[model samples]
Target: MIKTAFALSFALSTCMVLPALGAEQFQCPLPSNPNDPAKLEQIRGLLPDVNTMKNIERLNATIATLRRDGVSKSLMIDHLVGAYCLMVVREAPLTEAEKAALVRRFTGQVTRLVYSLESGLDIIINVPLTPDVVDAVNSVAEKQGLSGPAWIAMTIDDALQQQRTTSPPELPAGFSSSC
Candidate 1:
């Protein structure tokens, strides 16, 4: 789905919506390395601020500009997703609730784009995390070559690998067994 780049119309909730990309070879505006200072500057110049980005309509216009200026679909997808990921990790004066809300909405948008899932249409997961936890997740995600919800899923799976209960299930007889 790298080619998809989340060019989609989200279902349910008034979150962000992505625009469709066209088939035409063009030079990408941003550089390959996202960590480069120049790349960050370019992104800021092109995409505007976090508040502006929350507006789907404005974001669509920006996407149009990017497409017109030539941005690869894969890069678009990563940056769009990475943008929110990067924001949460920043020292911006955002509350825990604000950060969680951003993540929830962004996650929903991506899930809809990639899987065509929606509220009522299908099950959706909205993970709300504390500011410290969010930043921690983002850092670990980068180190592990994972991103966004994939990191959440992997971490959750790791924790749940050995299921535990408040009380262990009882054996049928007077005999008990080891896990």
Candidate 2:
């Protein structure tokens, strides 16, 4: 009985130790002082060669600022780290699908970018769209008998109305409204 107990303890201890030993050496650091150049340089060194080091640095700074602006969640920090790393190293902007995925991951909603216009004002907001999207929007606008901008405005208004009719806002899982 003693021998069996010893074996079980040993197995459990080894399982715990192995994970610690196999853990990654370099983690994306979220140090208290993000502006520290020395620490930033150390993280920069861990990355593979990429042409957009400045972009990475800028993204890091932006993340740090965001965290300081009261967004403190480990999952969000990790997501931002992964997203920025992939974005900079890949040397390409995230595709529309990728952006949607990121937004869903972070926000827990399948939402489009919504803009608000002030009531009783004739204002124009310039939203640049990809060529393909522009073509699609133009087609839809023509079919709806509205200008492209008017179609977009109507769509946004409809979405807003739908949200208001819902009992409560559906937020992302694990989302803290404070952030």
Q: Give the winner by lDDT.
A: 1
Model 2: pairs clashing at backbone N, Cα or C within 3 Å = none
Worst 10 residues of 2 by lDDT: 107-116
Residue 164, model 2: lDDT of: 65
Residue-level lDDT tens digits of model 2 in 11-80: 3222211113344422222333455555344434543333323355554454455446553332233334
Candidate 2 stretches with Cα past 4 Å from truth are: 1-120, 167-179
Q: Report the backbone clash tally of model 2.
A: 0
- What's each prediction's clash count? 0, 0
Superposition TM-score, candidate 2 onto the true structure: 0.28
Please write out the lDDT profile of model 1 over residues 26-85, one tens digit for every residue: 112232345656545455565555554467676566555555766543344445555554
Q: Which ranges in model 1 have alpha carbons more than 4 Å from their true place?
A: 1-37, 88-93, 107-179
